[model samples]
Target: MSARLRPLIAALALAAVASLTLGAAPAATAAPAPKPAGDDFPHPDLRLTYDATVRYRSEQAAIADGYQRTDECVEDPQLGGMGYHYVKPAHIGSTDPTRPAAILYEEDHKTGKRELVAVEWVVPNTGQSWPVLFGQPFDGPFDFEPVGPHYSLHAWIFKKNPSGVFSPYNPRVHCGPCPEGHAHP
Candidate 1:
C-alpha cells in the first residue's frame, strides 16, 4: 500500500477500535458508594485503633470526652449483648454522611463495664436510605434490631463482629446484667 494511504487507513482504524471498545462497556447500574467526607465535615476517624492515644476507652470515658449516651442502656439478651448509644457533639443534622460520630459500647457480660466495641456513623435520613449500608432499599432509615430505624453503619473497631465488620450488630457481642427475666444461654 502507499505510505500516504497507510497513515490515513491506520488513523481510521484506530478511531473505529476506540469507538467499539467504548461502546461495548456495560452500562453502570449504580454509582460507587461514597467514602467518609474528607475534611469537608470533620469527625474522629473511628477506624483508628482504640487505645490511650485515641479519645474514649469506655462508655464513661466516651462521656467524659464529651460523647453523650443517646438512650437508656439496654441489655440485648439474644446476642448476649449490651448496646450503649452515644453521639458525638457535632454529629447532628446532616453534616458528613460518613462521619464516625456515634459510639456503641459493647459491655462485657462478665465485667458489666462498657468497652468500645464499635464506632457508628449515622446519616439520620430515613428507612429508605438502607441500600448502601444494609444492601436493600426501604421506606426509612436502616434499623438495627432492638434499636429500630436509624440511618447508620457500624465498624467494630475495638472488637470483632461475627456477622460483619460493617454490620449493624455483632452476633458475638454480649450485654451483661440483662434486664429482669431476660437472661438466657
Candidate 2:
C-alpha cells in the first residue's frame, strides 16, 4: 500500500473500532429499588405499644423532624373514619431496642387503637407538645405513646399541670406510682 493511503486506511480502521467499543458498553444499572416500605429494622418479631395518646405524639415529632412528609399525617377522612399513618424511614433510630424503629398510627375517634409502626428507634428531642410551634401555625391535638422500654419517659407528650408545665406531680407522668391503670409495660 502507498504510504499516504496506508495511513488513511489505518485511521478508518481505528474509527470503526472506536464506534464498536462505544456501543458495546452496558447501560448503567438502574438504582437499586428503594428500601421496601414497612420492612421492620433489625427484625419483625418484637413489637410493642406505649400509651395510645403518646403514640400519636411521637408521630407528630417524626413529621416535624422532616423525616417523613406532612401529608402522611393528614387524616384520611375517606376511610370512613379519620386515620393517619406514620411512616419512619430506615435511617431513623428505633425507640425499642428489641424491634426496629416504629411509625405511629392514630385511628381518629377511636380508643385503644393508638400504636407504633416499629421500623427503628425514635429519635430523641423529636417529641414536642401542642402550643409548641413545629411547622407553620400548628395548634395541636398532639398526642403520642411514650417511647417504650428504651427510656424512662413514657410516650413523648406527657400531661402538663393545669398550670401548663410538666410536673412530676402532674397526673400525666405515668411511671412510678402512677394513677390506677396508668402503668406502662
lDDT of 2 by residue, 1-185 (tens): 78889989999999999989977865567575233222341223222332222323555565664445323332222221112334445633344433223343433222543433222233434354322111212222324544332211112222222322211122222212324754422
RMSD of each: 16.7, 18.8
State how far residue 72 of model 1 sits from its true place (Å): 3.0
The TM-score of predicted model 2 comes to 0.21
* Candidate 2 Cα misplacement greater than 4 A, ranges: 1-59, 66-83, 92-101, 110-185
Q: Distance (Å) between predicted and true CA of 121, model 1? A: 1.2
- For each candidate, the alpha-carbon lDDT, in order, equals 0.55, 0.34
lDDT of 1: 0.55
Please report the candidate that would top lDDT against the real structure.
1
Q: Each candidate's TM vs. the true structure?
A: 0.50, 0.21
